[model samples]
Structures are given as structure tokens and as C-alpha cells.
Target: MCTNTKENDMDIYEFYSGRSFDAYRELGAHVKKEVTGKKTVVSGVEFVTYAPNALGVNVIGEFNDWNETVMERCYDGSFFKVFVPEARPGMMYKYKIYHRDGSSMEHCDPYGFGMELRPAFASIIRDMDTYRFHDAKWMKNRSVCQGSPLNIYEVHLGSWRTKPVFDEQGNPLTPEEIAESNRVAESWYTYKEIAPMLAEYVKEQGYNYVEFMPLSEHPSDQSWGYQNTGFFSPTSRYGTADDLKEMIDILHQHNIGTILDFVPVHFALDGYGLARYDGTALYEYPSNDVGYSEWGSMNFIHSKGEVRSFLQSAANYWLSEYHFDGLRMDAISRIIYWMGDESRGVNDRAVDFIRNMNQGLKDRHPSIILCAEDSTDFKGTTKETKYGGLGFDYKWDMGWMNDTLNFFRTLPFVRGEHYHDLTFSMMYNYNERYLLPLSHDEVVHGKATIIQKMAGMYEEKFPQAKALYAYMYAHPGKKLNFMGNEIGQFREWDEKREQDWDLLKYPNHDSFHQYMKALNKIYMKEPALSAWDDDPNGFAWILCGKENDVVYIFQREVNEDKVIVVLNLSGLVYKNYHFNYENGDTMKVLINSDWNKFGGSTKDTEKTIKGVNGDFGFDLPAFSGIYLKPVD
Candidate 1:
């Protein structure tokens, strides 16, 4: 290696991916117990800190020897130090973690506010508590107490844009610059651009909140934000931590809340980062007793004190420094439960710790919302914390997604349609303190697209089924839609692939947009559809099981100016179909799925419907659903 530069010399080591694979993996757990990671300050190229487990971590700078490792890390509990071989501006370095168990790993900085896989690429050393600002200082001005009324728009950074790229390693890449190139085709976008654009779009579309997939840094180019490396930093590929701050500021300016999709369940086995900051034994758990996720990664030792510091710091940091309105914690089901244990994986101590986290965040900032993506039957997740709950404002109703998909998939033409199941979902989906979300998870990974999920007979069935999806929007619960769903995006989400933006030119695509806009009209405009969303009596329905078909009447707000949503789940069109409602002057048709614009020729123009003989009968199109507002 060349020397005579401005830097010193250091030892370099390597642990190929294929070398000691099992041992390498075991090290993730071992550190938590024996030599859990320890953080140390290092004066090397670029001025960065070194964690205890950094294996063969050495400094490489613009000066000094060009070796991979120089200024090797030396430890004294307070901090880790390295000469940086003469740390210089152009100097680059990488942390090398080797396990006493003979396993090795490499990764980027975990606490870095901005980071690259290796060094010299630039990384921000962010201490969450280091920042000082009091913007949303008086959160009490807002009447929305935690879960008063929150409608979230979930987004994934890599897929939300239309540009894509690949790295030298054949890894899928999403460089953040595509946001400004304005290339809505096969590209990635930067935070500086995406924030303003998304805020304006959501403000116009009438959504109150924005939920982003994980923003943490990671090495995998195509990662769906699930595999994380820099827990304390925003992905550098997007922009600096300040860019995210600017984005959130814009969102707040628009009165749209910001929520981060957080993954505290596990940590990526990054070799160059926190994994082996001090030594292999330093932050990680002692043995394999700590579980591993089905997906390849290191699980957090939730019960450990140091682990608690790391995780809690992460949660509170985002809320305070970034001004995030909330956090949607991913995978709570895996946190305190074991697979197939019937939700019996009870870790009371860990559960209490999570509750304490809620108190800690709110104690500092009372307005922060904490939501969970929990699918288990845990009873106290949403109960008041005073009652010994986990203190989450709400838990996602994952069962409803399953029930809805199952009902839609079993088409009568293919598999005999089951009306009872549909009624069952309607009856129980919103039973608990919950939220309903057609999350991004459901639309990808070889599962048929949402439109395809509704395909029954013809491409014609597409819009008809979509009409029912509109009904879902008006359902009595908090509503959430992935980024592209509002415009009827036709492609499966691929981290490496961009959205098919050209599809919007088609009339069908345009119609999907109009259709969704109409549903949101009811969702955002009507108090009956929103304010009382968590109240069940606010949503009551009656199903008349016809011999050849079924008809259901959904009523919102009894003894008041109310809306009635009727679904005709049969193949035949019926005129004067018997339906009864409290005596009202007439009824106005708000929306009908059977329209020529929406790939349907059965156009039913808006009209006033009347009740006859204590029964309101109206023309029902074949396989159609309608939302009607009872008029005076």
C-alpha cells in the first residue's frame, strides 16, 4: 500500500460474506450479553466516532497510507480512539467487526445522522438530544388528543418515485436526486424535493397525516426500509438529516402531521457500524438465546438496559428533533410473542418498558402519538395506560385486512361468494380501539395487485370492484392508503423499479383517480363518516338475505340527517328493490359504481329516490353498490 500521504498506518482485516457465515450471525446475539457494543470517539479522516465492536476498524484518509485500515481503534471504557493514520478531509475509513466467536460483519454508522456503507463518503454524527428547537411548542392548541381523528397516507421512498438505478455490486439502488430531475419514471427522489411535493399533494387530497416507511440508513440498495444500519440517521442516499427536518417543517406548515414508520424489532448485522463498535462482545446479547427474525437480521435484546437506552433514545429522538407527530411501530406482534403460541409470548417486563417509553415521550412532548402494527390478541395495547396498557394510542386492525381480502377473493363466479363473511367483517373489524389500513405490504411480493384482487369475470370487473373499495374508504374507521393507490397505480411495488407513471394517460386510469377522489370526498367532508368513526353505534347495518342474492343497508347516525349505503351483491339488476328507512322527503344518489366513465356502461345519473309504503325502493344495477344521502 502507498504511504507518504498525510495519514498514519493501521492494520486491516477482512471477513468475506461466505466466511464463517453462521458464526458471523451468532455474533449479533453474543454481543448483547458478553461484550455488547460500546461507543468510542475516534479522531480520524472525516472526524467520526468508533464503536467498541468495530473489527479491524482503521482510518483511511486523503493522506497517510491508502490501506483499508489505519489508526486502529484502542479502547478505555470512556471512549475508543484511533489516530486516523492522520485523519484528513479526503480520508476514508471503514469499521471492521470480528467476533470472538470467530464471526465477522461490516456495516455503516448506526447513530450517524447521515452515513455511507464505508467512510469518506460523509456521515453526520447526530446526537438526538444535541438539537434545540421549540416549534410546535404549545401542542395543546390542537383538539386532536392522540387518536381523535387521524387519516394517514403511507409512503415508501424507493417505490414512491419513478426512477431506479443499480450499483457496481448489482445491488438495486435508489439515489435521492431523482426527486428534482422530475423524472416520474424509473427513478428515486431526494427528501428536499419529495417533502414539498408530497405535502402540497396531500394537502390538496385532504389527508391529515403522512406516514413514511423507515428513513434509517442501510446498505441494501433495494431495501424496503426494513433492513436498517443508521438508526439515528436519515438515509444519506436521500439527503442530510436537515433535509428531513425541512420536509417535516413543510408538512407542519400545511397542517399535515408527520409519522415515521419505525422498526425497533431488530437491527441489521452491519459489520462496520454498531454491531461490533467496541469488540464483538460489546452491545449484543451474550448467547443465541436471543431470537433471530425469519428475515436475516439481529433481533434487539428488548430486556437489556443498554438496549433500552438505544431503542428509547431512537423513539424520543425522532419525535423531539425531527418534530414527527407520531411513530407507527412496525411488527409489535413479534416483540412480545412467539410464533404459534396463540399470542402467549408474554414478556411483562418488556411490555412495561414499552409503556414507559410512551410516558417518556409524552412527558417531554404531550402531543406525540404512538401507534402499533400489532396483529395479536393483546388486550391492553389500546386501553388507557392508567389501566396497565402499553400506552399506544391505537393498534392496527390487521384482521380486517385479511377478512376483507378473503371476502373479495372468493368471488361467486369462481368460488361461491359468502355474504355472511362479508357481514362478519363489517361487524367485527372495528370492534376494538383500532385503525384500518390497506398498507403497502398487501400490494406487493407476488400477491395479486389490488385491482387484480378484484378481477372476477372481465377487465370490466375492475372498476366495479374498485367501487366497493370506495365503500371501504367510507367505512367507520381511520382510513389509510399507500402512495399510488389514490390514482389507481397499476404496478406491483418494487424497490428497484419505478411506478408506471405513463399509465395515468389512459381514461381508465383517470377514472380510477376520479373514483378515489369521490370516496375521499365522503371520507373527508362528512362528519358522520369521520368524527364518530370510532363509535360503533355510529355505524349500524342490517342485511336482508334474499333467496338468490343479498342486500345490506348501512346507516350512519340514526334520527338525524343521515346517509345510507346499500350494496346489491347479486348478478341481476333490480328495480324497486325493497329497502326501508325512517320517513324522509327523498334520497339523493351520491355515487354509483356502475358508470361508463369507470369502465362500466350502466350509467345511473344522480336522482332523488323516494320511500314507498314505509320502504324506499330504487333501481339497483347488476353487481353494484351505491352511497345515498337521505334528503329532507
Candidate 2:
């Protein structure tokens, strides 16, 4: 039977009122040590769960030989708990919940810190305190990075780079043998094994942060960890919970921040998971019309206090326990309006829950970032909650992503008609603290890769692709690019195979890689590009209304330091083209996308040009971009 104490009653009140942010500490399987008057210590594990609708509950696991041990109900008749001296770390367990109709079902613990791999559905006992992190200095100095460069490299760990499979003789396995065996497990590198490799690669590539797709325990690899079954459990496919901790620790040691992709809207519909939990729709909405999401998963009913507490606690658990620097909340538009349809009216209950959760998380982790991946034009997504906003530090600019990609995909002859698509983003750039993303979503499911999306022949595509990237970097906002984007992979991203790293052997692809690396370096080193990104005075358009010329010129400035960007999207070159500039300032070419070294035909010449009487002239190559900075 469970021990009853006044402290437990208070915790239950807080949990049910949606006020407990650290509910994992009180609800899950916790290893405890009790000291007696004789100064000897007794060690045991205590299990706790909340199931108000259940008639009774039993704790059954390996320690008890899978036999049912009845749990004691607390005074409130909502929570059940049991203490077992025989329970040890690494033992698997589940709660057997008995419905009022005398039917019983075994369910994995919602707050379990570790879970079994797929095809298995048991929660494992894990010691969360075993791994000590050595990232105190990184943790202490971390911030939202509002005024600093925030170039992110988004990765899907499972397919980033798979390990080689070996047979029983310690030789590399043949293709037939790998196909016959469990290829999924054979290809994956554990979290600890991939830490150093990932750190070195990301640091070398010049990305300051790495945003991984959802890492929570899920049933389908195809879902990419979006449909979670265990909210608090890190998926065991990567390794044990401590292994994931070590991965984050290694990233911090390399001075790179880690951001977790969190899903707060839905859960997997697998029967063994949260579906009909406790013999009732406790976590999800009672009706299918509003309960099921468009992705065929259960929608969390945030109106329930218990549901809010469960989700908010799960969000807090990752940031507080795992040392993650930020959380990128996914599908926030679904939370703002019913079924993500603005006409269906706002989901006030869900919105309030979001506001409360965000406010609470910020109060707890003041320096950590809270980003929203919302597509709605819903106002104040990055505003403070006290001033009637959603309280996010950054919001993904979906408008900019769609518009810019559409412009690049148009044929050069017809690009004049779509010129405003590139300039439209600035009309509302400051609506929220935006992050410009070229994420994995844009490259998957027949959308084509970034380079492949260009509208031209194979040779013509390279220069246009180079020009597209130059324009993206010079635009206002934070930046994020998927793993394979930097290398100009022609093939779409596939989760089953590793990235086409072999593509680097080709001269065109290799040169594109070098160009991307150089662009990243300039972005990180220049203060004018990032230091005043959110300020209105940082950007100005010198040539926006000329649609027929298929040209764009803009100036990005921070105080006295300034840089001018010129882009030519047409097939015609403009020799000695003149544009208005600051008077008497000599301008030098910083980076030219059409240079021969970057797979272009432009020959090297005098790079510096003088601005006389507020006019600067330079040769603008076809389908090219160049950055010009004022000389001292």
C-alpha cells in the first residue's frame, strides 16, 4: 500500500488545478531512500498515477513477477500509489487500470522517463539523476539570441547518417543480410555515439544552434516523432534517457544550443497508448468531430485542468531536466483555431492554456527561448502575455517561406510578374519576431529539394540557386536550413537512407557547398545583418518598384556600418548599371554569386567601385547576386 501524507494531498490539489509545473517529480516512478532512527537507510521505488474514473489500479512489473499488486487510493479517491522494495532500475512496468464495468487494461505510465523500443510497449525504470551535466557555463550565459545571429541547422537524427551493419564474423554485412535482418536497429547510431560527430559537423558548418525534430517516444518512425505516446519519455530508439542527455551535453560543450521540437496538440491513437485511458476520454475530447485531428490522431482537450497540467509539465520536464535551451512548439495554428480553420472560430480554452503554459515556463526558465511554428496571421504571437500576446520569443515566418520559394520557382522570363512576391514579406516583417525557415517540410513529399525547385536547366540552375541563397541571407529575420540543404542535394529527403553525402564529389555540388559555407561565415561575422534585424531602421529598399527589370537592390545598415545587396533575376546582364547610394562612399564587392569559383562564368575583375554624387555603378551579371560594403 502507498504511504499517505499531507504533502501528497497538497500535490494532488496542485496537479488537478493545473498549477503544478513539476508534476513528474511527484507522479512517476521515483527511487527513494528512507532513513530510520538507527541511522540505517532503506531503499525502494514508489509508483504513482492519477485515474479518477478507474474502480481500482494495480502495479504489475518484472520486480513483482508480473503479478498484480493492488495500489492504495489516497483520501481524494483520484490517485493510486504503491511502494516496492524489490523494484530496481531497468525493470519494466505498467499500470493495470480496472474500469467500473470490471474490465481491466494495462497502460504505459504517462510520466515514465524511459520507454521500451517499438513493437514493445512497457515503461522502463530509469534513474534520472545518474548523469551529471558539465555545461554550467553554457547554461548560465544562454539567452533568446534576439539581437545576435541565430542560424539554425535542422536535423532528423535517425536518417542524418546511419552506421554500418556488421555480421556475426565482425565483417560488414551484405545487402541481402542487412535486408533480412532488423535494418532499423542496425543502421541507427545511439545518441552518445553520434554526439561528437554531430557537434563537430554543426560547429564546422557555422550554425550556432541545432533544432531536432520531435524526440519524444512515438510508435511510427514515419511520423518523425510528431505523434507522441510518451510525453515525458525520450524515445528508447536513440538509447537510454542518459544517452540523450549526453548528446545535449556534448552540443553545449561545443558552444551550440539545442532546441527541441515539441508537439502539444495531439497524441498517437494506438490502443496501448493514451487512447481511452482510464476507460474514459480523460486526456482527449469526448467527441470524435473535435477530438480527432486531421492527421488521424487524438486532439488533446485543453479545457480539462488535468490535461493542461499534463502537457505543461511535460514541456517543463524537457527544458528543466534535459538542459535544452529552447522549445519549438509545432502546429500552434491548430491550437489557436478549431481544426486550424480560422472560420471555425477560436479555441479560447486552448489559447488560454497556451498563454498560461508559456507564462509559467518563462517564469521558471527566464533565459530559455519559446518559439512557435504557427502559420496563422494571428497577431501577437511573439508578444508578451501581459500585453495581450502569446508570449513567444520567435515565430516561424511561413508567409516569407511560401512567397520566396514561389518567386524562385518561376521562370526568369515570367519572373517580372511575380516580383512583388519577394518584396511582400517586408510589408509585415515585424508583426512577430520572425524566423525565416527552409525546413524539412518544404523538401519532402514530391515538393522537390531546394536546388531542384529552381526553374532552369541543370547548368542554369546552379547560378540561380546561388542567387536565391544570397537573397535569403540578406533578408531580415533569423535563419534555419535543413540538414541536406547546404550541399545542394538534388534528391528529396528520405528518412530511410542517409543524406546523399556522395554528391559532394561532383564539382557543381562541391562548389555550392563551399558557397553556402562562405555565406554562413559572412552572416555570423557581420553585425549589420543580424544586430538590428528586429529594428525598422536596419533595412531599406533602393529599387523595389521596377518589376520589368527583374532586379532588386536593398541596403542593410546598423548605425554607420552598411552593406548594399544587388540581385539580377533576368537572363540579360546590365553592364555599368548605376544605382543611388550614400554620397562619396567607395564600395567594394564582398561576395559575388556569379564568380567563376562558385560555378559561374563571370571573370574576376576590379572589385572596388566608387560612389560619386550619391550614385554607384557596377556590372550586374545575369541570374546573379553580389554584396557591396563601404570601404574605410
Candidate 3:
């Protein structure tokens, strides 16, 4: 074992001060090389860890037959290190920490880059430089995607699609036999295996980005990776760390941006994980009242400088090392307020940590996007941290999702009473640069799927859903839809099952898919809908006073490009419905949600109308939406 006196002291000081955003580079298991005299060289793996309260720490792994090798203490006896010449890439290892009271336990490395697949937990030594990225052009041109189109398809990687298990005869396994076997484990596609398939699907669906739910190592499959064990490690459920790099590289080559969901609030309570490292509550709160989250996990104690460094470093590691274009931070409300409860007042320390981390990340990567999945009414979520605000590029508009879905779920005859549900969003639309989301959270846990949440049964849901999407695209924000939503799947989202792909065999489902594709096309082609989304003047309500009519009219305009959107949510059709149009411009129908090709009653015909004497007239159909643009 050899010690390097040069950079160790400075790195440890920065780590303890919470200023080390790249702590993983210095703290994790890294292979080192030393030049001995003229051309002689020596190589070994160097392990480093921080356990301030521990009596001692030992390096134990495959290199030493799982035997404990005592590590040298340094810098006020808080940090430990050891060199193992036998250690190499692909070997599993862990730290054996000895407590002050003479107790001992083995814990995975806090900054490990790879982890063993659970029900087994071990940190794997990995060569971080093995995979060479070829995404220079994509990286050079990547931005925050502001003032541009950003339609994200949120996906849960494992359940997006599963491999079909086959028997020895090369036929697919019977449902019963598959169930009797370890089907869940057998059906997962490795990260490298799923890349091309996912790229093709996302491209065909016309989405510019894919936001993975979470890929951090967690013991339970049911948590959907929200509760994490290995903060810096990619989950072994998919493949190695390099395998994940290949997946991102493939997606980037296909001109698709990738976003990873990052959790900073809590961690899993697994015995071998970060729950009680060094036999103390080092990474989490000590008392259960504030320590345990609603999800039954340990809440991170962000007041500690080490924990702050660890979380931010992990966030930076994904963007810097794995080449993710963005990170959508999960549950910001919990970070802003204790247990996400406003009544508990604000968490000032956690709030400060967020600002500092975001500012630091922005300084490092100016082009990458940092979004928040925050539901709180916290001010300045998307504002720059230098201006006393959270430095996020975008924030999810949870209010709009709730109000709109609730309005759609109400019976149509009574919908007039809730007309403002559609209009209320505009009142606060520009509060933070928003991204309207129909995410996985809305379609799970006994809540119905987006399609099933519509007011009526069978045939009636299609037109309303079509109309709802048109409104969503027309609204002043970016977009994100869960994996199964575009196909109008009736089943709720489940982590274990793939989306109902067979649903597309039916006409209603197939037509909806086509409609979604066409809608995406229009959204992409029309700059008016997205180019000036954050500008207050970009959208205007042309007609919204008649609540009893249940008809809403709006216009979105950018520069010389403009589009008028009309929606009639009631069951009654209005013939020659006249609305004021001061410009008296000739208009052509762009996309009618009631068109026959999209499973609607109206014939597939392009209709044109002219505004005369400051009034424009058109036939309005029930449960329909129409987009019209002035003829050039």
C-alpha cells in the first residue's frame, strides 16, 4: 500500500466543506499507476472513504478473498485508505467499518460506480474510462431546450418492455410456467439490449427526449428506483456502468436527448447500504420522527456537509460521467419543507444546499437542463440561484394536471360548472417556466389511467381524450407523457408489466396512436405553440366568458405565426357558431380532433372559413377540438 500526499488533504477539506462536486473522482475505488525509476512501473487499485465517527475501517473484497485489510487513517482520523495490487476491474468489494463501541458491519461504498443486482449487495470495481463517447456533435449543440420544442416521453426502463421467455423447444413459455419460474429476472433486457429498440420507438413517436424514471441501485423493484442505495452506482438490474453509457450513447446518436430522475430527499433502509454506515446515522437523520419518510425510507440529513457533498456529487457524476443531458430532481417539496408539509415550515439548510448545488452544477455545465418535479407553490423555482431563487430550468405544473384531469373526470352535463378548471392555469402559467406532465405518478396506485379517467365509457372517452391532448399541446408549457398514455391503454401503470402493446390491434387504440403522432407532428412543426411559451403575450383568451356553453377559444402566436384553438366539451352541437375575429383573416383548418381518420364522426375533409365584418363562423361539434391557422 502506498499513500499520495499531494492532493489528498485539499480534496478531503473540500469534501467536508460540501464544495467538492466531483468527490467521486477522489473518494471511490480508482485504479492508480506509479512510475518507479526510469521505465519501471507499478499499478494497483486505491480505495478511499470517509467515516468521521468510526474507530477504524478495512478494505475487504475479492482481491483479498473477502478478508479485511486494515486501512490507513489520515487527516484527523476521519478518512481511510488502502491499496490492493490484486484488485482489478469487475471485482466486488465493500468497506468493513469498525464502530467506537467495538461493533462492526460491512457497507457498500458511498461513491461506488457499479453495484451487484439485489437481493445481493456489493460494490463492484469498475474502470470508468473504458467506454469512449462519440456524441461530440450532440453535446456541442445540446441546450436547456428553452425557447424550443421539448416533448419528453417519461419511461420506466424495466417495464417499458420485457423479453419473452422461451423454453428449450424455442417456443414461448406458457403463462403458468413463466409465472412459476423467476420470470421477472428472466424477462429484463440489459441496458445495451434495450437502447436501439427504445430509440426507434421514441423517434417514431416524435419525441425529442426520453426521461427515465430512475436507474440508481435500490433493493426493491417496487420502489421504481425512487428509494436508492447506491447514490453513485448504476443499478445492476440493467447491466454494468459501461453498459448504461452505451445506452445513452446510442440514444444520442439517434438525435434523442436523455434525462435521468434523481432523488435527493431520502434513501432505502437496506442493512448493507447507507442506512447506518459506521454503525451510526451518518448519512441520515438520527431520530425516527423526522428521519423516516412517508415511503418508510430514511430521510437524508442535508444539514451535514458530507451528505450535501455526496448527493450533489452523485448528481454531477451522472451528467459528467454518464452523459445524461438533464436531471429531473424528484420530490423537491420534501426538500423545501420538512416531509413536504408546508405546515412544518421551511428547511433552510436543505434550501441552501439546493441553491448552492444548482449554482455549482450550472457553473460546470451551462447547457445541461436541471428540472424539478416540485408540487409546492414555492416561488422562484426556475429562476437563477444568483437572484435568490432555485436554479432550475423548468418545473412540472402539477396544478394544471390535477385540475384538468378532475374537470375531464366530471360528467359533461355538469362540466360547465367547472369551466374555469381549464382556464385557471393561465392565471399562474408564467409563474415558473413550466412543463405540463401526465407522468407515471398520475396513472398508478389505484388512480385510473389517463384515458380511463375521462367522464364517459368506451366510445365517448376517445374524442374527449383527443380534445384534452390538443389543449395540452396548445397550453403555454413544454410537455411530458408517461409511456402507456399515447396508446390510450385502459390499464393502470404497473412496474412489473409492460405497456399493453396489443391494445394497438384495436381501431380505437390504433387511431389514438396515430392521432398522437399527428398531434406531435403539428406541435413540432408549429413554432407558435412552443417558441414563445414563457412570454405572457404569446397566448390570449379570445373567448372564455360563456361558462354555460362549455366552449373555450384561445390563440397562440409567435412573430407572424399564429394558430387559433377551439374546444367544445359539451354534448350539444352548435351550428354556425359565430365568434369575433377583428382581423377578418381567411383561416384553414389545421387539425380537427373530430376528423374521421382519428376515430371521430366528422368526414376527413379540410374546411376553410373567412372572417367577415369582424366575425368568423363555423360549425362546432360536441366533445371536439379544432386548430385553425390564417392562410399565408
RMSD of each: 9.4, 2.2, 2.1
Q: Candidate 1 — what's its lDDT?
A: 0.61
TM-score-sorted candidate list, best first? 3, 2, 1
Q: What lDDT does the true structure give each of the candidates?
A: 0.61, 0.89, 0.90
lDDT of 1 at 597: 62
Q: Model 3: number of clashes? A: 0
Give the winner by lDDT: 3
**Cα deviation in Å at residue 25, candidate 2?**
0.8
Displacement of residue 222 (Cα, Å) in model 1 is 3.4
**Given candidate 1, what's the lDDT at residue 278?**
58
Which segments of candidate 3 are over 4 A away from where they belong?
A: 7-10, 33-42, 167-171, 174-181
TM-score of 2: 0.96
Q: Distance (Å) between predicted and true CA of 588, model 3?
A: 2.3
TM of each candidate vs. truth = 0.79, 0.96, 0.96
Instruction: Write model 3 residue lDDT over 1-632, tens digit each, in one string.
Output: 34567764447667778888988887879976668777634377888888888888998889999999999886657788887998988999999999999998888998888889888888999888779999999999998888889999999998898888898889887444665675777778999999999999999888999999899999998999999999989999899999999999999999999999999999999878898887789999999999999998999999988899999999999999999999999999999998999999999999999999999998999998888999999999999998999999999999999999999999999999999999999999888999999999999988999999998888999989999999999999999999999999899887777788989999999999999998988898899999899998799999997789999999999998899999998878989998986666588888998888999877777577777866888888898999998774
Q: Which stretch of 10 consecutive residues in model 1 shows the poorest summed lDDT? A: 24-33
